[model samples]
Target: MWDTVLIVDWSGGNDRGASPKKDAIWTGVARAGQAEDPVYHRNRQLAEAWIIQFLTDEHAAGRRVLAGFDFAFGYPAGFGRVLTGSDDPFAIWDWFAAHVQDSPKANNRFDLAGQINARFPGIGPFWGNGLARDIPDLPRKGLARHGHGIAEKRAAEQQAKGAFAVWQLSGAGAVGSQVIMGLPVLARLRQRFGADLAVWPFEPLTPPIALVEVWPSLIAKTIAATCPPGAIKDAHQVRVLAQAISALAPEDLARMLDAPGGTAEGAILGLGHVALLEQAARAPVLRNDCFALPQGVHWTPVDQALAHLRQHLPPVAGVQPQPLAAAAGQYLAQDVTALRAHPPSPNAAVDGYGFAGPAGTGAQRLTLVQGRSAAGQPYDGTIRAGQAIRILTGADLPDGVDTVVMQEDVQATDTAITFQGPLKRGANARAAGEDMAAGQIIARQGRRLTPADLGMCAAAGIGQLLVYRPLRVGILSTGDELRDPGSTIAQGQIFDANRPMLAALVHQWGHQAVDLGRAPDNRSILRGMLDQAAATCDVILTSGGASAGDEDHMSALLAGTGSLALWRVAMKPGRPLAMGLWGGRPVLGLPGNPVAAMVCALVFAHPALALMAGGDWPEPQGFTLPAAFAKTKKAGRREYLRARIRDGKAEVFASEGSGRVSGLAWAEGLVMLPDAAMTITPGDPVTYLPFGSFR
Candidate 1:
């Protein structure tokens, strides 16, 4: 059962700025048992960050989170394969995450729509570009284009009249931009939370976090009639919808997540049908205050921000019985105890003669038994007092042999052996189970099996083990200005560096690296690949399209689609990271810059991936070192500088600029500066993280 319910009314337009306004991003969050007023934000950035923090807090409090975003999670079915080269519905989210660039003052949604239209022979499906910008292929009116390639509305919308088509990007009740822009956020959230986050319809439901598409218009009349005249209508609608859903039993939400025979595009989760809204319209909207945070709070502490991830993000992988031969790097699902003693019976620790009891002071001579004992072969008869049997290292001690004397310390003759006096009992003789006892646990659950662990397991007579499945991480990238590495590059395009680096990073982390493929700046193609990616991987790591730039599609697409949680992480090289769920998988949307992407992946994603992979959250262990150079920065944020150890001190890279990819090669590790404003001079101690430590 969901312990927390959140309703979000998303807007695709630019930031509303410090003032309260209608048609902005508004959200209503209510615990399953509580009623609350919806919260409001001026822009997607703040709203997303707040939502993420809220979700994190709820998870920390052991609450199951269900968030409903007001947008289509997908476009029509044929539209997907036509636009993205895939039939999976969530491919659109991937498409949007790759191609849509957005900022408060501007966005390329209309341009993206125009680009999508150009992919078809003619524009007939999408319509209405009300923006002042003259997009090439997109038309100003629905009638301007013809030869419809796909249906204008989804099956869910067809059952509910007065619902606007997903193609309507402008004019009254258009939700096109809001939709594609909202998906990347979900894709990111899926990446960030890993197995802990899930989506509706496309994937099975899971606890802690889940996302569902919503439409406030399903119950707009019910909310409008009951709201006070002065209140913002967007805020009022979300509050009412949240109330209706929260009032429902747990099974009702489950049914919505698994809508039967869902449409090719998406289904609005508000009422499941127009009739349900009609049935609930008579109930008045309530005014209640729910979860609220202090206004204007920004720049979360870096440690506090990323530290909470492991505490709540549970492992999404399942257990499998794997032979020790193939279980390296996989986490254990159960303990592996010893099946037999390491040395099953007492044996000679050294090549020596064995006899019963201790020897008296002074050199002593004893007669040796006729037969000798070697590894895997033991003397058949028991040794009597004053007699010794020849033994080899690792040979089982014969009966009555309590001690052994090394051959190096004895003079041997044909029938007798002489050794030093005052030999202690059991000296140089291995007792049974000395190295390991039977029934002793050799390795515990959730331990990442290493070469040593496998060796120990083998010695313990364990041939197979139950291990958690390795996390499958999909790596994706997007940008028109980007071209594949080693490909012929155009004048303006740079080779794609992020995807390859991230894929390598994923591989280095011991998780399965899935190349989700790359797409040009077009949205439809990206969507097809994204849907394929979501279907293929458990978590995704996307570099580029993660920032507020007009070309940043990853974060924008997620805002209104799945659950987008923006983190205003206070750190240099990387500050903002987009996290969300797309089609029930986790996604971590990283900065476009290569340096920032690598740093963020190390600082945040590594431990997160480990925890998601059924292993303990591991923090990089760094050592303090003296600084060979001096530097200073503002105190509010922590900073990481690429540096190398020179003459026993840390020497920073020539420049602090992130674009200097050469710096990454030049430095051996990173020197971290604390949050306080302080200058580092030569001889000052600072924390240094070597590249090896992260892995």
Candidate 2:
């Protein structure tokens, strides 16, 4: 039996500027000893990388990995003949792989669908595109107005109700885009992994990584009522499915995978639907398919293949010396040791009379000494027997004198003093090195010097210190639709919010904020801007044009000219992060949506810049507060809800969208939801992080 089961609720929507927590693609994983929580992915490119990395890691640990994707793996049998001149289901996969254009920001699904529709007798067996994407003949909505387009339902869809036509590319119930977009990725994965991957029903399950089609709706109805309110509907569905599979008997799971079936688009996995799956899996493998795994080949898991990638991450930047006066908030590069012992020599801790041997105890009269010991003006001579010196606080303790009696505790007359209270030896005197000994470590490297820490350094005779220099951060925004905030707005243009906001944030974090301004949609200009930023700044930040869309020139530039180190992180309000090196300097590409841009800047870029500036990475510190709202979250990805503390509880925004900047503006802080599959309720303690902490 597989030790790890992964389920993905695939999306065909434009996820370029989506919130990570609620994107079109939601992935849930269930490990033998782990809790179920789904992780969200906005950019399919990054998602692919993460999936490959995850599977590689899991297999390296010797755990069996079973993954499911929610989409039609193949079209209805006859349609494959019409589309690819063959009944072999894999022909369509090969066709898509040969033609589909996919990137971090965009895809060619609509255009390819139009071309496919043109080849058919009439309007699409494929249809639907927004007004902006209107093709020559396809209708924007509803059924095909004309054409001999085939509408035969796939066998799996016929088994399940409310299934959409594979011909519809836009609107509700449309799986056309998904098929066109998802198949290409699958083909790539199949080709990349070769014998290591197997597509269920189409190929024999001899490999370690098995790709299966899943219809969440098939088992979702059974657990709909059991799911808690406010929980993400899709997340709950995938979680329940993974849970059911993990709870099944090993023999039962094997039987389900071996189930027989007729048409592709694949079988839905569920313990309740085991009979159907077993029949499908056991069905004779389609030998006629253009794509098939070779028999008798061993496969490597994704986890094992990518294991070394994690260990060879880029190192943090070098350190620089900074003066003590300019070192506030800067991380120390070296340890600070005390120059001399605290209270160099014994001194009076109180204003009193210093005498020999405590004046022999109890009410003894002592003659006055020749000198008085005051702060900064110590008595040079030693006190003789039966003599006392008048001393003030912080004055050096004279030789032969070990105790001090406050004036209030003794009666003083001309040239003499009479003790009224008992005096102990060394009373009211601060000893040398009592607070800190010489050569003691005052602060260690990587510690951000605080006010109290600075005071300590000053007292230890440290007038200067070594620290990391401030990081020079350059902010840039792309897209022709973005204009300066105060500029006149034309039709289809919005004021740019990311550049100014990120620049201010960079400054607030004590880094040099270099405004590279906005780059137009032209690739060459964008490349020029990036080069300039790289020349002057240590790190570069940009929003928009990071997706795979054709107009997304920033991504094209990075993918073509620079090295892309990271593409996506499993986080909410921030998912699409294009990280790489440009001209030997690091760059971070944020989503175009303002709220997402801000969230990603804080969560991902801030810490990275800090590290490059020779500072220790800071983790968000949170406090537990009662939840005023209820929610359900998937495991594997972290999310932050724009929320505020109200009536001593955390309340999330009424609307949740990456574009909702007003909600972020209204929020005082963020409610941190961990990467765990669980439900939260009112009055439950949730971790809350204030903006002040991050800023």
Candidate 3:
């Protein structure tokens, strides 16, 4: 799908009649339409003209033209080699060199191989025998010294507008060249252009007359001989090769196409087509389907389950605890009625207070008479002329007393207090209904009891609270081989860990866990226990007896009861889990394995209990983590893996097996590998459902 090409000279020109001669001219070309086919020519002038015309025409058409030529854009010494046979082959090289070097009008130029090697004297061809030999680094160098002559030429042609894609083939001539040269170019291109670019390469070689008939055979043989054994046979080898070629400049393509030994442009095009096909194959596909319920089964989603339980569960009817205590500071309220502030009348807060005065005379002083009120009790008598009441904080003022003078501002004599400061009528007094009026609703139903609520109710004179009863959950383990802890463990018997685990889990949800004890493997015994549990408990939870074995009586009993909602879910480990109602009570039957039982209980039991308690279900939350190792799983089954986060990434604890308790023990949380994921690799992001996400 890419529209540009840059061809460079690495094996030299094909003008010397397919001889062993190394004479080659690195040419740059950009074309929108096909050019005239090449004819046998001794002079390299035609080849040069074809390149210049292709580039000029493509540029004129407003298409992005990528020109690939031979030369290390950085160090000249690392440029690709040009084959030559003459005594002074440098002359032909100098002539071709003059074209690119002297053409100042050329724009957006890029050199592919050894064309720029003159700038770095010590560097050599990367793929030749001595590719690894190091060279001295250049200093204070600009574009000319960097050997980006072709790129400079192309830029001049572009008039300095858009960016250029330059491919620097690092490894090409010798052993290990495929990877060494390909990886660097691919990595840089991906970094610059993202992963969407298409790369194609052509290998060209002019064959000698003696080898012309066997040239095709020789090309394959030489490739096989030069590549390591088994390299060509590797499944990923082609992919790697394509990725490498994708990084080369177009000039490299032209130079290789002009090689003396072989040329197959069609094979290069095919490789490119295959690469595109592979990318398409990697795209994801989706399918749409609804969750199915088993025949005659009445399963409901969690939200519906909650609503059903709430509607069917019987409400508790009983006397509730009184809101307040009786002793001093112990009981703030004594009855069901709201609280009332003291002083059925008006009151004063200061001392040396209160007497009634005429309506017009403002300055008034009254005699200190009776000490009347406190916070809880009100003053009863009235105040006469020139008489005032001595009041304390929150004390009620007597009738006919409208004002009071501060004790500090009154001069006290034997039987009377004289006022030094003038007093205004009704000063320093408290009025009725100032703090609270009666009959306001201070507390409501279904509200969590907080200290503020309690205080507000107390202030409003509420003495008792009407709170709902806590849900009671029954926990039963249904395995015959199970035994409670603190008892002697006989051979072939395991401790009843599930019972305590389930009980503690229920308690954690703010519900009472009614231990129904472990039931034997007999159907009648299990039925009787479940019946009794359903009679009193809001929900009944049992572990084991839900699998396909003959001893798995839970599913059978549930089916017989005609109230079983769902027998099996489309999930792993917990697939045998059964959700149903027994004797009008909700029942959750979990798998026998400890981990499976625990996980299912967290996922389903917690929500069911919260529903029974008249609460809403919460959604599960998880984080993203990179998979620690590659994994392959069944295509249509969602698998939950108990894993731990390591180095800020997810790592499965161990291979998941329903019977493996050690795996659960080592896990920090669960990793939800979806059903659609067929395989996972390191660094692949996966949903890390932490243990906290469950409960």
Candidate 4:
């Protein structure tokens, strides 16, 4: 049997009406076994009788119910009016309060007090006597807190006594106003009711509601009344409706709901429809919360940790560059000034003959003067008619010379030159400040320095540039049974490969890696090395000694020093990872097993380096590849399998032990298998994460 959900609208309206325009009866019937759906008529006597009878019936049935409503059960009488003006209003609580005030017991002191006290137990004195007193200037600062406290208390009473899960949704108006007025009340209820009182804002046009609200009238009719099993024909129809509603896109729905005339009531109905459809569709419900590490917990989700760090880290300030050599391959420090401190005197761009003419395009011949002018030198005397001077690129054009015929264009005849084409004023001439202007942003902040950028800065008379300092990473490995490569192992000792692998990884990320000598299986010596590294390096990474075994002393040392942030992450192979502060510096402890250490480092170290380098961390790169062979897995934790690419598909490599170094050599990348997915057939798309050049 499925759980029952009740959607109650306490506003003044009847489910059925007689007149075509006035009669508003819902003809549709709710699926069998669901809770009662009631539209509380504004008629106080009738509504009170109906509510009492409904509660009596529910109490006799002994079944728990989850109720969703459009109004805040704990809202102060005038709170809604304050947010949404009373003229364009849909104030449920206000109507109820007015109805209560005008009831037959209006003259009865006990009845009036009970009505007010039901929602605000101790506030009758303030409303009735405080303003009437001579000292009416009493502080009202406690009113808001008092109101919130009462709302929470009432919501708790509803949940504990009635076994209810109450959901309060907002209507159309100022969204900010609704949130401000509604959230505090809902939050108070949630604190006491726990999951039983799940409160989320319902935007009618959002995906979740659209998916469920497709047939709003039908769902609303069904929820508004009780019906027998045969009246609705098939119960699965409800499920189908729910599934379809749940599948609608949220962005599209939000657009629709945000349109004019979209009201809180409309949004509530939309959400109710969605919920009903989901129930009928038999869709799975997902419970999600912001990622966080519990007290004393070790390994945390990499995304969560990175997000927290970003919030706490201060903004990086811009700095000027040091020198040209240091600025090589770096972004420009600032905008470059123009090549010359002041504008250059007018010059010619080409090395050719200069001449004086009528300053227009139609020109025929020019006599060449024997004098020559090279760059940085100019012909001092003015040119005569039909006369020209030999000039080089960057040399000032003599006065009265408005054009330069290219050397190729001039046909030399001893001391004279004949022009084949028309010559125009200002043609082939380099104007002052032609390349760049002074004080322009020649280089922007945060841009990577390129050859063109460097050249431009140098041309602008800048010799140095400022850049972010490189991140420093220290790599260390621990194990008495480890030996460096090329050194013969004695007895049970194995080769130390983690240090080199990690160092290479750090360098690939553009960080400076300092290789700290290996530590034997001694806690005191390991602690001292870690302390020293933490004092100098931005991040300290060590392999081995993370587990809780006798040889696993890294966790202990970290705990004794500063503070241990996390000791273990809920990941495979790298489950016993450690993260903490040592002597005010961050430390990451990886498992001693070669493959495990490398994978963990990729998952964590790469992101840390990017953050420290003043760059946004890149998303984990994933590729789709077919499974080389069939594999079975437990349906809980994510799994990564080492595989090689063959024929554009992933081929699983045999021998995947965490301690096996040969596995790393054979595999090109790792394949991520999502949790709750047990088997994947050949040709099924699986995400491949590359570790080498393939990335």
Candidate 5:
């Protein structure tokens, strides 16, 4: 993934004479998750120098840079071989570097085209010049232009609509001059970067500086919608494109930079013929790994599996603004900075008498003022040296007030109050901005806001918050021997317990659960159910039929159609875990047994759902307590024992089998054991995870 993105609109014309007009040289720079306005340059030389410096600084800071230039990087097939005797595109770049005579505002691009045409027979391919005088062998129009033993359009240009051929030099949408001038800049950048630069569609993208060709016309609608009125289109194109690409999720950006389309003729970064680039910039949840474990891996550790999920999973929720009252329990889409400070001024911390006192004075009796200072009312005049005013709690401390004595400590008479000794200076006095400050980020992006967080936001003068919509998780139960809770169970069938429990869990986690009811073990029924779930839900949760067996139709159908990954975790009571994508929606398959299903949901699915719901990855907090009973255990994997706190010590259930559905109801928490063989004695420390923490 790139840490910085630089998009440039190259110009072939001479200096536009300062004052920042359109169609000169515009470069947009996006870094650190923010994009700035495009910088304008009057000439190509100044733009080239500025870009080189920007790239150099970014590389020096150890940031990967992706540079996109809006021009054709290469000619059609066989053109490079005809010009440089090789099919490699770099060979043509070398030729252009050696022959092109470029200055600050003038270049020999037209003369070079005429000279190149002299080598061919009849009228040459490069045509349509704006020269004041006619040049030999170069035609003024394309009617006499020859094919020159090569195709007229590159493969990428053929796919892109309104893409003018590189041969046209003096017409609307002409790119021939731009290609001539831009390639030399690329050549110099490569020379300067040496081993650190990579030109895409020509080589692999393992270097720090990735140079790719871009056509902004592919997303013309997006640019038109985002660009401001009366602004230059060239500058807006580069600026908006940089911001949109920079906002893409990391995995999608890498896919867009897939290289080596062809060495002779380059391809645009995105296909340019399809809406894939537009969708990628607007919505980026399409680049998940289906939670598939790495190749050659099986029975992954729980911690490692969690880490993989955190790395690959993306936020799939849409964003919007809501009032703070309705925004509770939603994930914040942006940072909320304080507009004004809470406790806006200095005030009294408690009810007391206020009067200015001398630095080293002993006890003194003062006259009580006529009026009292309440919460919203203040005394008009400052307290004199011999007079004190009664100040209530939360009342603003008036001017010339240094210290306040508690009313309980002062001996009050009908007209005067007496204090024993000089109190500490500024005692019981609150300073300005004691609670909050302006410009302070009270809440960060991707944070799950609580009731207290809403209160803090309200105190800081924030009325509305931009938040992500709640994730819709579908609860699907698929099993042959499953029945509804109220239905009579047959000899081989049992009532379904996991569906209601999981739906409740989803509700507790601040997500909506779309109950998909139940599907039989038949593949056709399960496939139809999954398809429907994918259409309406952000994530799907399957109860049973997840194993690699004939009756496990969920796994069978997923493997056949979309993608399947059976993640057998190295933990007890919860191992039969499956994750996949059906119709582009994430699906998590849990074990059939009630105990194991609940455990897996808490230990694995909880955090994953939080991430997909656009909140930060939640790591459940656990505390340690002494074990109430002693036991010997050997382990190659971690284990969670259903336990509860008894007599201030952790106690495990009598049975450790997953078939004991009552154990899930009886226990209040789970005790986590590490993957190491050890004997537990009485009073040994054990880690306990509460059920409430999972929420």
Candidate 6:
């Protein structure tokens, strides 16, 4: 129900009495259809001040916000009673508010944790403050002589596998200090916002500013691969969480906030969005129900879903066998074993004379035999001790012959051959099974056969191969402003480029591209075409009707007859990438802008289609080169600028608009910008991915 979603990656380290420097606190923002770059915060105080002011400004503008903090908002059920003299978590929040102290330079998290631990009678429910040298209650490690605090983990933490115990107050991966330092900020937020803000699980979630507990680890596995290497861990975490939360639909978000027993660690959203969609699509086969899912969630991550699909989705089910010549570009459904050894038997490697025994000394001459050995015609008789047989290249070696000298180094006459050079035992001869052995696995199941693979199978005597059928792709273009190229020109109408471009790309990728034709803004026509495409094609691709414009019909169509998996991915020039399933077939809705549509198709749709076609997704190949241009980019959204390599440097297009189709035509590749706030200097290193790699 919110218009803006913010994810906070908080830290509890003592900024050493100064503002945090790096790997500290990070915050990311995602609006209804736009994801803002993440902002770095040096300390909790600054972060709190910014959040308060930002939320105030947004609320003043009548915008609703869903803000999630990455820290426990409450303690375990019974611990709340011991800490605040009540079983209610809100009471503990109030207690922390009154007891904790924070500033840009320092915080009393360790002292407060020690104070709270003293009430419980043990070393911990709170321990580990390496910064506190003289603290009696909170030791750096191990229990004190008289310490015995409870070691209870919150239900949400336990449900989130690999989650650290909340009692571990210090050391690596410990969130206890964060809980103590962060709750005070939440308490202040609640006080300032009052009824405007609602803490999930503890308060009614109907407020304009909802505060929910979040664990980035819940969605980390799904997005980790997409994140750039050597990126700041905290910044990356918040960005991923923001993207995941922004991608969730309304119903799915509600189910996550409504999860049971999330009062302590807070309700983790974006962890169940995938599950809700899976449930709606009746694709629960990938869900493992044994683990405790937050409330109605039976979800799996995108990587997990892809893996499951790759494993269980049989190679085009019941595909027919095809000849080796027709197997190129298709996935092999069965393993191919070598039928016979290569070179069937030992053969000569060159046209020469075969000698019975090795040449004892240099300049040795031998009398030639009447029989000759040529390819496909071997002599029946063996050579005598002082005689040699004439052998041609690829001819099988006769009995009593072990080596052959090159014809160029020998003198030959009718019925006689002479070699004047010493011969090695096995020189110039190909041994049986040298290239391939009998019963060897030349190709395994699920391998996409290439031309070389087909030739290898042919050499191994495999005439036919069992392979998956070709993937069928249906392409569509939607919008009244879009008209087929070469049609009569009309006012305010642009020739359609997305359909033909996408169709050609699909074909180049070895799929059968079916042109579903151009669709107007009419819902009936769009729905009919979508229905037909879903029923007949393996995947449906469309452009121009995915946004919120009045003419946008893809969203409504998916909402009515299908389930939209994700909307508005956190990407520049291509935020409006809508993905879902219609009639059990996958649909990738790209943007209408030619440049954005092409980039989205390559970066997202391309890999997705590969996975659907029972083939491994191709990783984007790139090389590092110095940038020949300079620009400032935002963090949290990935951008691919039309660029090319010139003078050994990467150069970008002059204009950065997604509608500039000429940029794609003018550039040979793209310059990839990671999701971060940074200034690119002319000599700085940039990643360049050639367009040919995608093709």
- Find the candidate with the highest lDDT and give its number: 5
lDDT of 4 by residue, 298-334 (tens): 4454445556555443212113335766665333323
**How displaced is residue 488 in candidate 3, in Å?**
2.9
Model 3 misplaced regions, further than 4 Å? 1-466, 693-695
**Candidate 1 lDDT over residue span 382-410, tens digit each:** 88888989899989888889898888899
Measured against the true structure, the TM-scores of the candidates, in listed sequence, are 0.58, 0.53, 0.38, 0.44, 0.61, 0.54
Instruction: Tell me how candidate 1 scores on lDDT.
Output: 0.77
User: Model 6 segments beyond 4 Å from truth?
Assistant: 1-318, 356-361, 384-386, 413-422, 548-551
**Which ranges of candidate 2 are over 4 A from the true structure?**
1-321, 356-365, 406-408, 417-425
lDDT at 274, model 2:
37
Candidate 6 collision pairs: 122-147, 122-148, 122-149, 123-147, 123-148
lDDT of 2 at 150: 63
State which candidate, 1 or 5, has the greater TM-score.
Answer: 5
| Residue lDDT tens for model 2, 373-487 | 9989988898888888899999998888888888788788779988764666788888898987899998987677788988888878788886655667889999888899888
Which should have the higher TM-score, number 2 or number 4? 2
TM-score, candidate number 6: 0.54
Q: How good is model 3 by TM-score?
A: 0.38
Report the backbone clash tally of model 3.
61
**Which digits, one per residue and each the tens of the lDDT, describe model 3 over residues 44-127?**
444445544554565456444443323222211112233222222222233334333212122111232343343434442221
Please give the CA lDDT of all the candidate structures. 0.77, 0.72, 0.49, 0.51, 0.82, 0.74
Q: In the order shown, what is each candidate's alpha-carbon RMSD?
A: 22.4, 29.6, 30.7, 21.2, 16.7, 19.5
Lowest summed lDDT window (length 10), candidate 3:
207-216
RMSD of 5: 16.7
Error of 5 at 202 (Å): 47
TM for candidate 5 is 0.61
